[model samples]
Target: MDSFLSALKISLWVATSSTLLVALFGLALAFVLARCNFRGKNIIDAVVTIPMVLPPTVVGYYLMVLLGREGIVGAPLYQLTGWSFLFTWQGAVIAAFIVSLPLMVRVARSAIESVDEDLIRVSYSLGKSKWETFVHVILPLARSGIMAGVVLAFARGLGEFGATLMIAGNIPGRTSTLSLSIYSAFQAGDDTRAGQLAWVLTGISVFVVYLAGKLSRSRWM
Candidate 1:
C-alpha cells in the first residue's frame, strides 16, 4: 500500500514531462502536413499516422531495437555521450511519446487544416515572410487545435502500457508509471492495488480530455 502511494508521484512526473515534448514535435509535424505542399505529402502523412493503428507492443519492440545500447541508432546515441536509454524513465517517456504521437499529429493537422487559406494568402501578399506568417497569422488561428492535440497526447501518454512495458520494463520507483503500476499489481495478484491505480488512471484520462474540450471550446467564445 505504502509502496503504491510512493510510486504514484513518480508516474505523474514521467507522464507530464514526456507528453510535453511529444506534443511539441507532433504539433510541428502537423503544421508541416497541414500547410506545406511537397511531393509524397500524402505518403508522409500515412507513415506518420501508422503507429496509431499498429499494436503498442510492436511499436515498443521497434523502439527498443533502435534505442538499445548495441542497436544501430541506440549504439551511436549512447556512444556519443555514454548515456543509456534502455529501461530508464526517459525510455518510458519515449514509449509514451510514440504511442501518443499519431493522435497529436492528427489533431494538430486538423487544427491547421481548419484555418482560412485566404488569410494566409493575404499575409503573403502583404510581404510577410513564411516564418512571420506562421507566427503571427497561422499559429494564432490554430491555437485551439494545437491545444486539443496536446491534451489528447497527454491523455494517451497517461494510458500507455504495452510499449512502455516493452521498452521501459516494469521497474518500480524508476520507470513504473501509473499504467505500468496497475499492470504490475494485477500480475502479482494484487487486485486491490490494481483497482486503485485503475481509478487514478481513469480520473487523469478524463481530466485531460476535459481540458482538451475546454481549450477547444474557449476558442469559439
Candidate 2:
C-alpha cells in the first residue's frame, strides 16, 4: 500500500511537472511555428515532432545516450553541477516531457494558427507590440485549445511507461510511477494489484480525455 501511494505521488509529480514544462516551451514553439517564417522551419517542426512517431524505447535510448554519465550533455553538466538526470525523478520528468511534448505543440500550434489575422492586425494598428498582442489577444483566443493540449499532455505523462522505465528505472519510491508500478506488480505475479493500478490509471486517463474533448468542442464551437 505504501509503495502504491509512493507510485501515485511520483506519477502525479512527474505528470504535472512535465505538463507544465510542456506548456511553457510547447506554446512558445507552437507560436513561433504558426506566426513566424524562417528557413528550415519545416525541418524544425519535423524534428520537434519526431518523438510522436518514434517508439518509446527508441526515445529512451536516445535520452540515455544524451544524458548518461559519460554522455556529451550529461558529462559536462554533471562535471559542472554534480547533477545527472539518469535514473532519477528528474529523468522521469524529462522522459514524460519528451513523450508528451508533440501533442501539446501540435494542438497549440493549430489553435494559434486558427486565430483571425484581422485581430492581430488591429492590435498592431493600435500600437500593441508583438509580445503585448500575444499576451492579450492571442492567448485569450487560444486558451481553450491550449488548455486541452495541457490536459492531454498531462494524461500522456501519467501513462508514460517504456521511455520512463528505460531512462528513470523502476526504483521504488524514487522514480517508480504508476505505469512502472503496474509493470512491476505484474512481473512479481501480483495480478490483483496490477489490475487495481491499471484500473485506476484507466479511470484517470478517461476523465482527462473527456475533459480535453469537452474543451476542444467548446473552443471550436
Candidate 3:
C-alpha cells in the first residue's frame, strides 16, 4: 500500500504539472489558431494533433530518438545544462505533456471558435485591444471549456505509458509512474502488484470519464 501510494502521488504530480504546461501551451496556440489566419495553420493543426493519432509506442520511439543523449536536440541540451531529460522524472513529465497536448489544444480551439463573433466585433468596434478583448470577453466565456480540456489532458497524461517508458525507463521511485510501475509488475510476474495497480488506474479512469461527462452536459446546458 505504501508503494502504491508513493507511485500514485508521483504520478499525480507529473500529471498535474505536465497538464498545466500542456494547457498553457495549447491555450496560447489555440488563441492564435482561433483568431488569426496564416499560411500554415492547417499544417500546424495537423502537427499538434499527430500524437493523438499515432500509436503510443510510435510516439515513444520518436521521443526516444529525439531526446536520447546522443540524439540531435538532446546532445546540445544535455551539454548546456548537464540535465538529462531522457531518463528522469522530468523526462516522464515531458512525455506526458507531449502526449496530452493535443487534447487541450483541440478542446480549447473548439471552445474559442464557439465564442460569438459578434461579441468580438463589438469589442473591436469599441477600440478594445486584442489582449483586452481576450481577457474581458473571450476568457470568461470559455473558462469552462478550457477547464474541461485541462482535466482531460491531466487524465490522459496520468495514463501515459509507452512514451514515458521509452523516455524515462522503469526506475522505481524515480522515473516510474503508475502506468509504468504497473507494467513493470506484470513483466516481473508479480500478478498481485499488477492487480492492485490496475484497480487504482481503473478508479482514476472512471472518475475522469465521469468528470468529462459532467463537463459535456454542462456545456450543452
The models' CA-based lDDT, in order, is: 0.84, 0.94, 0.87
Tens digits of per-residue lDDT for model 2, 79-181: 9999899889999999999999999999989989988999999999999999999999999898889989999999999999999998899999999999999
Worst 10 residues of 3 by lDDT: 212-221
Best by lDDT: 2
Off by over 4 Å in 1: 79-82
RMSD per candidate (Å) reads 1.7, 1.4, 1.7
Q: Give one clash count per candidate, in the order shown.
A: 0, 0, 0
What shift in Å separates residue 86 of candidate 3 from its native position after superposition?
1.7
lDDT of 2 at 77: 91
Q: What is candidate 1's CA lDDT for residue 95?
A: 84
Rate residue 142 of model 1 by lDDT: 85
Give the TM-scores of the predictions, in the order they appear.
0.93, 0.97, 0.94
lDDT of 2 at 82: 90
Residue 89 in model 3: shift from native, Å? Answer: 0.6
| lDDT pick, better of 2 and 3 | 2
